[model samples]
Each structure stands twice: as C-alpha cells, then as structure tokens.
Target: MTDEVAEDDYEEVVENVALCSECDDYMEHEILKERKVGTGRDLLLKCISCSAINNLQIREPKSISIPFILTDGPHSARVELAIDEDEVFNIGDVFEEDEMLWTINQILDKDKRKKKTILAIDASSISALRTDMVRVKITATRGEQSDSSSMLVEYGTKFTADTKIDYQGEVWRIRAIHTGAGRTLKGTVESQDIKRIYLHEPPNPEHFEPKTPRERRQAWKEGRLGYNPNPEIPKEITKKRVTPSNKRKKKRPRK
Candidate 1:
C-alpha cells in the first residue's frame, strides 16, 4: 500500500510539470535546459500561447566615438573630421584636432593668392545704312590683343534677330532679348570667347486690337470659303434580265 501511494505522488508531479502555465490548462510542455562547460546552467521557459522564449544571458551594449575638424577656405569653408566605421558625427563638428584645421587654413590662403583677370571694352561704333540694316562694331581687350567683332542691328527695333561675335578664340551666340530703356541689345555668350548679340523692340500694345466674339466666329466660318454638294442617289432596287440560253444551260447542268 505504501509503494502504491509513492507511485501516485510521482505521477502527480509529472502531470504538473507537463501542464502549461500560460493556458491554465493541461497541455504537453517541453523542458529546454542549456549548460556550458565554463558558464553556469541556464534554463529557458517557452510559452506555447505566445511562442516566446526568454533569453537567459545578459549582453552589454557597445558604442563608438568619432573625431572631426572644421576649417575655413577662401572660396568656401568645410568641416573635416576622422570617424570610425561605427561612429556618427553631426554637421559643423570638428574632429581632426588642430593639424587638419591648420592644413585647411593654409589651402584657403593659397587659393586666395590667385589674381583675377580683368576685362575691358575699348569702344563700340554703330552705323546705319539707307538699306535699313545697322552694324555695330565692338572691340574688347583682356590683358593683351584686343578682340573685335561686328553685329547687324535692325532699324525701328531695339533688339537684333541674331548676331554672332568672336571674342578671344571662342564664339558666342546671342539668345537674350534686351528690354531696358535705352539699352536695347539682346546678347549671349555663344562660346568661351564669342558672344552673339541681337536687338529687341519694346512691346507695342497699339499694334494689336482685340476682335469681338461674333467676329471671331465669323472669321472661323469664313476660313472654309469653298464647299461642294454631294450627288444624290436613288434608293429603288433594279432587277436584271435573264437570257434563255443561260437559263437552259443552268437547267441542263442540273438535269
């Protein structure tokens, strides 16, 4: 009788271990145990309802730092810094200590040492002919030889249609329309050394008049001036006459 009682107690313990704690109901549960040779034993509890396993080991968080430098230049300024592959740095932060800062300053100073070239225009002569064609001669000098070019200007207009000019060794095409009072030249640099200049006329509102809506419609209809009527056709059906020889031939074939 005592052996039976001990067996009953053992069975009860096994049944309790197999029951799932999350569901509050009796269900099959798996026991997972991990033990390392150097580390202590670790036991993980897995819930069947959530399907989640608890991590037993605690891990430390890792972080990194980066350094940078900011320097000013003649044309523009920049920030230089040294950063690790894992490090992050914000803008305007200096990290290269003082060495990179001095290097950047020196580069900026050297760039500022460059001298800018100055360009000067000699003179421009405008000539008008009886044929209504106008010519403009322009001479410009930049350091050495004076480059000269000519453009044709139209009369009664402030801007020219198209004109090409060569300055230095490059050619420029004119694509601008000048509309300023007294300065009525439209020009653009066609190439590195050439400029194309043209003349433009001011807006003339008096030259155009708005037409009435009725007049516009009338004009549209009048544009199709010529019309032709289609010929009429009769709808009556016509019957064809049958020849006796043909009818006999058809009957003979059937026979």
Candidate 2:
C-alpha cells in the first residue's frame, strides 16, 4: 500500500498537448467521465474555454494517457527570454523553429513549467557606454580626393585629445577637444599617413560599376548570369493548334 501511494505521488502524464482548432491555443480540459466498453476504455473531456467535448480511447494501459487536470500544482510562474543582441530567432521562419522552440522550452522548464503566452522577450542589446561615460556627439568630416564626407561620432569620456583610433578601415588621430554643453566634450580627428598599418587587412577598392547593355545581354545568353525563368515559349507554340470554326447556313433571299 505504501509503495502504491508513492507510485501515485510521482505519477505524471507527459502527453503531447493538443491545441484548439478554432482558437489555435492550448485548451483547458477536465475529464467528464470514463467508461469501460468491452476491453477498451473511453474517456470524455470537456474544454473549459470553448465547452467542446473531446473523446479519447485507451486500448493499452501504457500506450498514452493524459491526466484529468492538465496543469499540476501551480501555474502562476512567469518566464522571460532576454536577448543581449539583435533578433537571433524569428518565430515564423522554418529553419529557426526548432531553435526557438528549444529556447522557449528551456525557459518554461526553468520557471516551473509556466505557459508560453506570458513569456516576455527582449531583443535589444545592452549599451556598452552608460549615461556617465557618454561625452558628446561631434561632427567628423573626412576629405577624399574628389569629395568630402561627414558623420556624427560619439566620443566617450575615456578618450582624450591627440589619441589615435581606427575608424572605417583607416587610421585617424584626435586633433583637439573642447568643453561642450552639459558635461560633454567635442573632439576632432584627422587622417594619418597611408603606411602598412593593419595585418592581413585588404585595401578598400572603388565602387563596382555594372557592365554595358550589350555585354550583359551576351552574358545572359551564355548562362553566365543568375537564375533565369524560361517558360519555353517555343515548345508551347508547337503544341498550340487553331480550332476550325463551323460555317453558318445561308438563308435564301425568297425565304
């Protein structure tokens, strides 16, 4: 009797939950009754949400079984998924379905089997520079042979005047720093000599220009281009046949 009670205490039904066909959510069910017909047992359950009745059959004792009460002890626990970077998993993507489901299950298990609907998800990465470390936004302008470009740079509090740093595959040294509004500092940087700087760093090349129209057409005909969708118009034209029209009977002028 003691062994039977211990077995009952640890008895858990790990059944694959079925979602509602109407609402597409897990249904809360309670076993209405069970009847033994011949050698098989039939269990009837009614969903609390939709009030829909579902019948389950039990042929073998160990095949599959669901508990009368779907949830165990308490279902109040909440689960949270915090991402420290950009979105790594998309829910609707087929390739990431397994990974997303695995991550969700891990969170649910850790939070005492909480429902997945209440799970909180955060996708933004934590900022490295805090409110105190932020110095000021400075306008950074770089001059090229033909044109000049400018961008707003965020200078941290740790950086000072005459400090060297790398930006956009080029070496730039800070020229000057001035006190700005609200405990901030504005800085300027200038380009240095084009010496052999970085190890294994490839040189930046000019923007690519597409070939001429005649060259592109030749490349397309030789199949050097990417995927081309051809409906095989020539083959289809051979299969098409013009149907003969029936001639109408001409009535006589006297009639």
Best by lDDT: 2
1-255 in candidate 2: lDDT tens per residue?
A: 999989889966634244555556776667789899778888887766787777767664322111111111122233332332323333222212212211122212223443323212322111111111122333343443222233323323244455565655665654444332222133332211111111112233322222789766655654456655642233344457544467677987995
TM-score of 1: 0.14
- Judging by TM-score against the true structure, name the best candidate: 2
* TM-score for each candidate, following the candidate numbering: 0.14, 0.16
Clashing pairs in 2: none
How badly does each model clash, as a count of residue pairs? 22, 0
Which 10 consecutive positions of candidate 1 have the poorest summed lDDT? 118-127
Q: What is residue 248's positional error in candidate 1, in angstroms?
A: 99
* Residue 83, candidate 2: C-alpha displacement in angstroms: 25
lDDT of 1 by residue, 170-253 (tens): 554333433322232444322212232332233355544337776554434444223424322222311234334545434456
